[model samples]
Target: MSTERAREGLYSRVQQFHAEQMQALDSGRFEEYAETFTEDGEFRHSPGRPPARTRAGIAKELTAFHQERFAGEAVQRRHWFNMLNVQEQADGTVHATFYVLALLTRPGERVPEIAPSCLVRDVLVEEDGRLLTRSRRVEHDHVPEA
Candidate 1:
């Protein structure tokens, strides 16, 4: 395959991982969502919180967040990725950044409310021909990094 074709293939796989992750999170399959990362992948939900790197740690945090976010509420949640930009870095890792919209739909609500929108940067690496998130950072709007 030509270099261009190979690049396109890589892009497709990354997008697939992103899409699958969204589905898993939205459907409340927290463990499945965590599985999208590498074995030692890390996530920093906020600057203050310590990163979660272990598989069990990832699952634990995700489950806790989901429960707290939807506590005592019957609603559907969705993650929308906008303007995704995926690039191949010189170091052989893929850098993906995009605006993320966290939407919540409550009972009797016609439109989903935007809980928040943030910029997410994901460092991805191909493991055994599949893309996995090596690390992720999220920045909420107007929140200056410390």
Candidate 2:
């Protein structure tokens, strides 16, 4: 394959990877979602909070947060990623940036509630021929109150 063609293919693969990863997360597959990252991957959400380090840590944090957030309700969160920009680095790592919309729906609700949109940046690396996230940072468009 030509260089340009190979890059395009890589971009498509990266987008597919994000889709699968987000689906796993929305489906409440915590472990599976965490597995999308490298073993020692880092995940940062918003500002002023410490980043979750390592796959186990990421899974633990997500499980607790999700459980508490939807405690007694059967709420579903649908994540939509758009305007993805994927770039391959000379060092062989892939950088991806995209905007994500989180839609929340509850039982008997006709319309899903939209959460704050976020911009996500990710660094992906190939491990054992599988693409895995090396790091991720999510910045919400809404400003949090103190």
Candidate 3:
């Protein structure tokens, strides 16, 4: 494929991967959410301290974290990505960086609260004709005071 075409294909794959992750999160499918990554993938949440080093770890940590943080609070959450920059590696892997905005809506709240935007850095590899994340880093653009 030409350079342009290859870039376009990578872009589409990243977008699809992001969408699938958002869907998993929205539906509270923690296991599916974690499965979006490779078996040894890692998810590092900025303010949360320790990182999830594996898919199982991600599911366990995220499930407990979300429950503790937002338990019993009916809310709508949406994660959006913008300004994605994708690069194809010599080994055929892809790396991308983008900004993320997370909007949260709570019951009785008039407007949704926007989590400070963050930067997402991802490394994805094509395995068996499928794109899978090998590493994901989420850095807070602005962290709220606790």
Best by lDDT: 2
Cα lDDT tens digits for candidate 1, 1-146: 56655455666777788999889978988788788888898998765778888667888998877678678888898888888898999999999999988889999999889857799999999878777888998888867778
Best by TM-score: 2
Which digits, one per residue and each the tens of the lDDT, describe model 3 over residues 27-122?
Answer: 788899888889999888666687898899989988888898889877778888899999998987799999998898887888988887998899
Query: Least accurate stretch of 10 residues (summed lDDT) in model 3?
Result: 1-10
Q: Root-mean-square deviation of each candidate, in angstroms? A: 3.5, 3.8, 4.5
TM-score of each: 0.87, 0.89, 0.87
Better of 2 and 3 by lDDT: 2
lDDT of 2 by residue, 69-105 (tens): 8988888889999999988899999999999889999
Clash counts for all predictions:
0, 0, 0
Model 1 clash tally, residue pairs: 0
* Residues forming the 10-long window of minimal summed lDDT in candidate 2: 1-10
Whole-model lDDT values for every prediction = 0.85, 0.89, 0.84
Off by over 4 Å in 3: 1-8, 108-110, 143-146
